[model samples]
Target: MSRRLRLLVTTVGLAALAWLLLASIERAIALAERFEGLPQGVRWLVGGVLLLLVSLGAAVTVWWLRPRRPRAPVTAPDRTSLEARIAQLRHDDAGVEELRSELTELDRRRASARTYLAVFGEISTGKSSLIAAMVPGAAPASDARGGTTREVTHYETSAWGDGWTIADVPGSAEAGGEARERLARAEALRAHAVVYVCAGDLTRSQAEELRWLGDFGKPLVLAVNKADQWTDIERDQILQHVREQADGIPDAVLAISAGGEERFTRRLADGSTEDVTRRRPAQWQPLRDALRRLLAAGPSALEAQRENAVLASLHERTGERERAYRADEAERIVSRYARRAIVGAMAAVAPGSDLVIQGALAASMVRALASLHDVRVTDVEVDNLLRQVRMTLRTGTSVVLAVAGNALKAFPGLGTLGGGVLHAFAYALIFDSFGRALAATLAERQALDQADAGERMRELLNEVDASRLRRLADLTGEALRLRHEPSD
Candidate 1:
């Protein structure tokens, strides 16, 4: 702005402030005069109330601005307790044999008493070349298109010290590489220390991986690979940025070249061009120095943290297995109850009382599913949940019967069974929808959510996929045949 305009704006701001100040002073004077006119007791009461209000406002301000404490990091249980938990899962038939195998491998590696280091990074980050440079005469496959390393390969190297073993694992961040990333992570946790290789500053995923390693207390070094591509100043800046990004996670952050092959065309004196391949000399002295310092503590000193990391990973795996087991068991229970509902509907002589008859079965199925998911539910809660389901089914009864009629027509064999089969199939859909809705709500909220389950039931009642209808029809047929069989 021009000098005159700037002056005008500044003057206006000052004038506004002065006007506000004068208005506040006048208001305070008027309040004082009114207070003097009041009785002494009322004046004291007013003053006390104003003091209390001001004190409360100050207290609230302080509370709003208070510094919050960070949440404590999660720690894995000791090996003995972790193994006990895994054994309990096995006894429960949770299919945790793979977790058991992980424990077995953990013990085997510990028994070897070797210092293990894993080279970890995303695809095409020179992880393989770095390994080849560290281990003489050891060449690992590398492709410019990425994902060349598919499995974990260990090389015994005495470069750092005796019994030092380096592991080369698959790279992370590949398309369809989630399985390989899991393998790479498990191997990293199995090691005494890890070197996270990156070509530049950390990406979001890379930073997260480093944080995960830190959470497991894994000893780490951040290596900025392919450093030969940048000049000295640029390399130094990148190293500083990497160090800041990794911060407390890695023991050291250094720039190094992994000595990869570069292909180019050479012209001879005869003027004919010849293809030539040359390997870049690896410049990883700083990396070597960092590894030496990290390993100076020896494998024995690092064993506790490594074991903790492995057990923590195993604990997570076991929990996943347990959830899967519960889900499968819940499905079986729902199918059983749904079959029972179909049989009950088929046998009922009175068509109008079918819903009243299925109410008890629905309640039973809810209890069964809740128990399977380890969700505690009271008798009152179960009754209330079933009441809600009954109301939902009442509203969607026509929709459910329509779906059942469509199912009967869809299957030629089922259509000849008569009208009773339509009622039976409707019951099957009802029980199936109710059971599934309750099971899902219990699994997610860990409590009986009447409103959510009722909404889900309404949705499931109208949803008649071909596969579901076929299964229900087959079940009705089987149940009817069994009922007609003579009592031996």
Candidate 2:
């Protein structure tokens, strides 16, 4: 009801109470005057009975209408507090459960996606250029401002077979930036192998890149670009430079020319395939060979590309959901808190907690139980649990209240039984106790969720191979875990 309407009703009720009190007083005064004028014998009995009834009725009315105070609102967690909580959750048992769930899911998706052969190298090394040409097609042309290909492109060719996904990320600088982000995504995707590309003469920039990322290192497939343009002297010099770049790699360097040599082939309007082999422009054959070796080691490359495409899409959506769940954790806890408070306040006013209180308690209990499970929690998830609690509590309250009303009507206890104050007190005790207990229980559950969330994150991180992910999976696995896990 509107505040104005509520205020008006309260005033009316107060006025009625005052009028009834005044009437009783007036009746007593008149009776006293009558008894004073008549004999005193009959007056005592009538006066005593009237006073007792009025007193009892007044007490009952007060118990029914007295208001309970409102509860304080729950605030968003503090930044430092939230951070600490996130840290703490990482170390707990609940976190381990969460990690197990994420790891299992990631393992399934990675195998399904067949994300093998990640290309890692410095900018303009023709890493993108090479993958683009070999796959279904090239990435969409872009201005490439500041040499940043921030977009991690995926190329799929169903003709290759089932379950093939090829991931192409921005080139890595030893400094991270776009390449590092790409690598993180790659790790999540679970790429089976890595193809590291280095272009031209291989500057010191190439040597330091791998060492800088230390742990993010991957099995290297060193690809050298612009081999076609080099003279014999230049080739020797380049080969020497490439050796330094390959210093840390397990395999040898693979060279390719981004530009064709003296020979060139072009499609004519004749719609016929013709071979006019000029001196092979920088041959991508070396790069191609290395890629094939990677495939030979595992599943079909073509199928991997195709599967990667679909899995990439699913990974994204699921990741988004997980992040949201993490953020919503606090809200879920607060909701249960509010409901419990409501019930407690109601119980305080009513003697016994209403049907709403019981339903709320039950719902909170069930939700707390579920949050403890291995299943990932999200805001939508917890909200659904609380919603059921509310609905059940509301229904229960109505039923119980109705039954109580019927019993009261049938017995008419207030009219002739022991004082109503005793009944009011009893009802109030039940209601208040239920609300308090529910709140206490909900508080405990919230603590558990808050504590467990981080451990789960750590578990996920541990399950993924940092090197494998940095090279092949990119941020796919990270995305999946963040998406599935709820924010609290």
Please report the candidate that would top TM-score against the real structure.
Answer: 1
Score residue 378 of candidate 1 by CA lDDT.
90
How do the predictions measure up, each by TM-score?
A: 0.78, 0.34
Across 1-488, the per-residue lDDT of candidate 2 in tens digits comes to 89999999999999999999999999989977887776577777777888999999999999977763322212233334433334434354453343334334444654555545566667767766666555635443332122223465555544344545555776656464764654433442345555666666566766665443222333346667777666877877887777755454434575676553244567779976666765333467766676566555455434443234324423443344444444355345534443343324422434233435444454454455345322445566555544443444343544434433433343343313332322332232223223333333434444334324323322322232334323212222223244449999
Backbone clash pairs in model 1 (N, Cα, C under 3 Å; residues 3+ apart or in different chains), count: 0
The global Cα lDDT (0 to 1) of model 2 is: 0.48
The sequence of per-residue lDDT tens digits that candidate 1 reaches over residues 1-488 is: 89999999999999999999999999999999999999999999999999999999999999977764432334777778777767756464534666777777788777879898999999999999999899978544331112324577878877666887888989999999898888899889989999999999999999999888888888889999989999899998998888778765787888999998999999999999999999999999999999989888888898888888888888788778767777888889989998888888986553335567677777788888887777888989988877776667667767877888888998888788888888888887777788888888988888888999988888888786899888888888888888889998
Q: Tell me the spans in candidate 2 whose CA falls farther than 4 Å from its real position.
A: 1-105, 113-115, 136-150, 158-163, 174-189, 212-217, 260-282, 299-488
* lDDT value, residue 453 of candidate 2: 32
